[model samples]
Target: MSQKSFHVAVVGATGAVGQQMLNTLSEKNFPIGKLSLLASKRSAGQVITFNGESHTIQEATPEAFEGVDLALFSAGGSVSKQLAHEAVKRGAIVVDNTSAFRMDPNVPLVVPEVNEQDLLKHNGIIANPNCSTIQMVVALQPLHEKYSLKKVIVSTYQAVSGAGAKAVEELKEQSKAVLNDEPFEASIMPCASDKKHYQIAFNAVPQIDKFEENGYTFEELKMMNETKKIMHLQNLEIAATCVRLPVETGHSESLYAEFENGNPSVHEIREVLKSAPGVTLQDQPEEQIYPMPALAAGLPDVFVGRIRKDLDRDNAYHMWVVSDNLLKGAAYNSVQIAESLIKLNLL
Candidate 1:
């Protein structure tokens, strides 16, 4: 960390992930000379406090990037696509949290624990992977380095927070409606822009983004494809199933993995994870200790637990992973990328 500070801008200042960006900036004590919060017209003029100082939210425009050394964007794909280049043109490096730019060949999608080296390769805009993907890669990267991972099959129990602030409110209202035996309305889960919405109050939704032609939701495909991209492992095999749960925060994942030429015992895995950066090991089965989303809310670190061997395969293992979705998975990851850029001397 440097004594001198940098000017920073946050796009989508009123959103779920946008709020996380502010929390992360303060919690990390990021040497911020100035912080500018940008949102749509609807959220403009709202006030958010940072470092005990009041900062009024401003409307997002191309001009927001002037004098900003870095920009953390979480508004949406369309917003990022429109303004990211403009920010870069103003000499501000962009850490974008939208699906719009993740797969771009010109952009680098990064998680610091997973591929900090990729920061050195950015051309101005850096992409942040999906929240579920971010936590999984943070846990898997160390193990992959030790054992040379061959495959990954993961299922995620994501929270309503990943959907947005509105979705969280919808879940709460619908739950109360159901409990009172009122006609519960369904208009938020599954997909908001779709023809219909499903109830997420007491139900689980198997979809995160809309389905693609291959039958995998766009969110699931992001994990599978983005994993290989970030790891730079063209031959790696990955599969994902993403589901939205009623929880307000935290995302938990069950991962099954196989390693090539890996014969390490469970203890060895624990030792490796304990030494990995931004990761914590909580694998005590007999004591009933494990990672759970309910316990991971509002935390920055990735939590790992339930480490064990799969009975069906000798080189296979199973694990549970947890983290705050909006934090680590989105806003925090974007901030970490900016931090890495500073450390790597790229900015």
Candidate 2:
């Protein structure tokens, strides 16, 4: 609530990540002279409370951006593709939380801790990196700075919430059905609109998004490509395998990285990550302490642990990373970009 507040709008305000965005804005006390909540036609007129005030949701349309200074979008790739440009055209800065324009070559894929400076190059819109990518890059930025990165291999245990609110409900309902030995139906998982859906309770699905000709799912490719882009290492060799777990909120990853320079000691890497911004070092093998999705739920910082050098390669190391997919991955990161814009005088 500053004197120089701006008009702000949260598109898709009724969805999970969208609700989180509104909560984040209120928690951070983001300067807002006016607040607009927008959603699809079906959700229009729904009521949402923020700062103890109720605001009716409006239908998201091109004209909704009029007089808005900042727009946070989490509707979907298709919705973003349709309205983000319209928002930008109305002089509103858009921080898109979808893959709509992530690799557009013009839009900056940003994780503030990793490549905030890239925000200066953004043209009206900034793309938030994948949830898994965001946490990984946050934990890796300091390491990559001290020891140049050569390659990365990541396997992610992602949460069902990343798919959306309905997916989380599906997980709960399916879990109960299985426990009770009752029949249950699954029609929204792995990829909701894909050719088929699979059970996400008491099971792990290897596919996250649609598969490409190269045999990699789109989610895996997003992590691989987004890491290189955010780290500004265009030629960085990276591979990712993304899987959906039964967890409700946090996403976890097992990361193996090779450095260009000789391998740094495990202690050295620990010391660096302990001091890295937005990263919490939780490695303590002897005491059985490490990052877990349950422990990381509702937290903002990326948790890193299980540090050890690769068995055969002297220049390679592996670690575990965990974070709340909805916060740092989607909502918090978008708000952070708006803060960066103000701090960097770009707004």
Candidate 3:
């Protein structure tokens, strides 16, 4: 830890990802001169314990960022859109965890392992890539660099926690009801603001966010777009189908990728991932070992396994990727960006 500390503020302090940010900051021993917890007026004045000390949650207003050095935002997109610029105006570098400013030309969409240098281009606000995008890029970065990726097709099995706390509770309640053969009405599963919600306990919901005009769900589009931005592959062919599963924490994805020049052997791919930053290689078919959501929960590293060559295409490969959605996918990545800024002297 550095001896010089800075004042830090966390927006949406009561939410799942916000709380994880506080925990990550404490666990990583990030130097903190002062900490501010900001949330909506409804959650104001709440007490939260961090590093065995009590701090009161305050309302997230333009004035709340006064004297703050870094502001990590995980609130809804609307709150981020409203307050992020205000924080920047107050001289705070913001690592926003929502999609509000992701596609902005001036904002750097960052995944520290893949694009930490992108932080150097940040005007003030840095956009954290989508949770699913984060883990995929972390795994794909090494491969992309070595093999030169030509195309990517991903199918994600996302956890309920990505939908927020209410969705997690809904899964638990629905699971209990279903086991007891009781009737359960779902009010928030695939999308709360959408027309209908589906059961997420024993079933998988194909939709992650509202559908766009192109028939892709917003979540799927986010993965596709964010991948190109983070990897600096504007012309890369990418497609995603994001589905919500009964799992509570980790997010899993099955990826099919094609390289440009030559096909890399499974051992070569394993070697690339073994040395990749923020990635753990767990491929062992004989032992029946591979990355799984249950094993990846609570970890910061993206787990990659199930490496295999495509049967028909010599330039194609397949793999499985998993990560704790609330950690590496959100909180830990934001904190890592803050660390990257410090390392690169961008802060």
Candidate 4:
């Protein structure tokens, strides 16, 4: 007897993360009998290759999802909001890689390493956490399990790639212009929808998404809220300050956390992280070694290091976490969810 294969669809097939998703699926050798590449009407005619086979990009409509057993969506929040249910209605289980259904009470926000069981409860759609949030939780979940996480204070140094492919190109163009002292346009950094744009070539923008009424940018709130939801810690005291850095890929975070358990030694924390699933511990300060975004790019596992105890708070500790925002942050996580679905026999 042969194993069953799925008819999988990749929504947003033309974008950066979308491209990575296709690459990852090929790299992982997922059991796919048929692959459908979907994008906006404007991107419909583009051709993409998967597993040495050519796949045509099609305009994503509710009708396009007809026999799709799984749909991986990364187009954008609006597209997900508009078409996610349509996919679900057509018998496709959706693993959404956007903010669209993340906070929905009925949807499961999943990080397989942290909450793989949540997938079983998903009501047709499963929301992938924010790129920054995904990596942070991967590194923190093991420690949280051992120590019972009480609070988290994170400051993110995100990359331009998190914005989109155009932002990465803008950073390149702006850097060249800056070096030659030529004039350049500032149009994409901070947030494309914001009133004013800032250069991201050699500067940091202290914002990721639109600001909510409470003053936290949507990105920050995603990290804060998504962590709580994924961990099932509704009262987890978490605060986030997300900043866009000039780096082209990977995201880094400076995290300070307090645990309910009494103070644990740095060695103990390192021991916990050493065996933590989906985490790579790279903390060797004597060798001046630690996780850096430049080194973390292109990797699927979350790299964590710089473990130290806070001087004032006995139960508090700080660490640094990094990962490829395009991989584990979005594409890899979405695919992992689909793999989990099959493993759990939910597909």
Candidate 5:
């Protein structure tokens, strides 16, 4: 018997993460009976190649989801908020790669390695966690399962690509200008819509998104809140400090966690992570082997290293985690949720 296939539509097909979604789907050989590439009015009529065939992009509208069985969304929060339900109403299951629906009590925020079972409770829409949050939780889940988590504090070295393609271009332009001693105006880093933009080249910005009234930037809050939602640890003591780096891909984090139940040694924790799903253990201080954003770029697995026990607290530990921001962090994760839906017969 032939395997089942679905009509797959990729929203925001012209953007970076959206392009990554198409690449992942083709690379994974997903059973796609028909494909629809969608974007905004400005990006419509653009041609893209997929599965060795040239496809034209169309304007995304409620009516475009007429026969779509599965829709992967990565446009932006506003686009997802406007079109996700329309796609769902047209009988499509949406795996949204935006923050619009992540905190919705009805929509399940999913990281397959951590809380795939939540997919069973999804109501037409499944939200992918923030890029930084996804990598941290993938590393933390095994530890939490073994020792139970109490507190988590993460400091992120995020890639400029997290901002968008335009931000990435701005970084490159700024870097060249600085090298030539030329003056360049800042416009996209930190937050494009904000009043002030900072130079991202040869500098680190301690903000990722717009600052909230409580002083935490929106990106930091996403990491803190989304981790709790996905892990089902609503009361989990969590805090985040998000920083934008000059790198073009991959997100790196310094994680400090305190566990509740057991007193596991460093070797035991290393062994646990070594066998954990969707994780690659690279903790080898002797050879200076550790996870790095450069090494993790383009990979789907979360890379963990520099695991050690805290001197003051037996239940506390420190580690480093890294993964491609656009892959495991967004596109690959969204596709994995769709695959989980099929495997569990929930689609």
Candidate 6:
């Protein structure tokens, strides 16, 4: 680690992902000489304390970019699209946590363990993939490298927290209301502003984000599309079905993959996953052990378990993966990118 620190600015510091970014930065002891928190005018002047010091949030504008060496942005797409360039023009490198620039060819959609080298090629901004996509790629990247992943099909049971702080509170309130026989309203679970809102308490909603022209929800499409981009596999076959579940935190996935060469034994797969970067293998079928959302909450690394060979598919395997969607999926990954930038001298 470099003894010299950098000036860091965190945009959208009032939002969920942005708050996690700050926590991750402090916990990881990121090299910070100065810290700036930027948010909308609505949140400007609000104070956030860290390391026993208080820093006030400022309105995010072009002028706020002055003297900023690195900027982490998690505001909505509109805000990111509006101010990310301004931050860059003011000589700050941005790691954006919105979908605004993920698909832009010039901007690298990065997950450090998957593609740390991508940061070196960034044109001032790096896009962080969706939460679902980040954890999936981290687990899959190692397998993709070893087994030559021919295809990936994943179904995610995501937690309410992925929808932000509001949706989390909504779930808690709806649950209490349901338990007390009180009629609760649903206005935020599956696409907050969509025509219809459903109760997420004690229920599963199969839609996340809005449906796209291809009948896939935007969240699902992000996993499918962003995986290919970050992995640098233009021809990788991927499908995703992202769902919002009633869980408070963490995201779990059922994954099926077809390998190119041979059917690796269950033991081999476990060992490979154990050695993979940013992954923890928890498969122990005899003792009824596997990855689960409850155990994964607040953890930084992706958890993989239930490794087995597909019955009919000679080269296919099945597994379950879990992680704290807010940590490795969003905040920790962004912080890791900044670390990579420092290690590789990209910043």
TM-scores of all candidate predictions against the true structure: 0.97, 0.98, 0.99, 0.99, 0.99, 0.98
Candidate 4 regions with alpha-carbon error over 4 angstroms? none
Candidate 5 residue-wise lDDT, 251-333, digit = tens: 99999999999889989999999999999999999999999999999899999999989999999999999999999999999
What TM-score does candidate 6 reach?
A: 0.98
Q: What C-alpha lDDT values do all the predictions have?
A: 0.90, 0.93, 0.95, 0.94, 0.94, 0.91
Put down candidate 4 lDDT per residue, 19-43, tens digits, no spaces: 9999999899999988999999999
lDDT of 2 by residue, 1-347 (tens): 53578899999999999989998999999988999999999999999999999999999999989999999999999999999999999999999999999999999999888889999998999999888899999988899899999999999999999999999999999999999999999989989979999999999999998999999999999998888889999999999999999999999999999999867899999999999989999999999999999999888889999999999999999999999999998899999989898889887
- Candidate 1 ranges beyond 4 A from true positions: none
Give the C-alpha miss distance for residue 188 in model 2, angstroms.
0.5
Global CA lDDT computed for model 3:
0.95
User: Candidates 1 and 5: which is better by lDDT?
Assistant: 5
Model 4, residue 329: C-alpha shift (Å)? 0.6
TM-score of 1: 0.97
Q: On residues 1-347, what C-alpha lDDT tens digit does candidate 3 reach at each position?
A: 63778899999999999999999999999989999999999999999999999999999999999999999999999999999999999999999999999999899999988988889889999999899999999999999998899999999999999989999999999999999999999999889999998888999889998999999999999999999999999999999999999999999999999999778789989998999999999999999999999999999999999999999999999999999999999999999999998899877
Clashing pairs in 3: none
Report how far off residue 163 is in candidate 4 (Å).
0.4
lDDT: worst 10-residue window of model 3: 1-10
Clashing residue pairs for model 4: none
Question: How do the residues 108-200 of candidate 6 rate in per-residue lDDT, one tens digit apiece?
Answer: 999998998888789999998899999888888888888898899999999998889999999999999999999989989888867899999
Considering only N, C-alpha and C atoms within 3 Å, which residue pairs clash in candidate 1? none
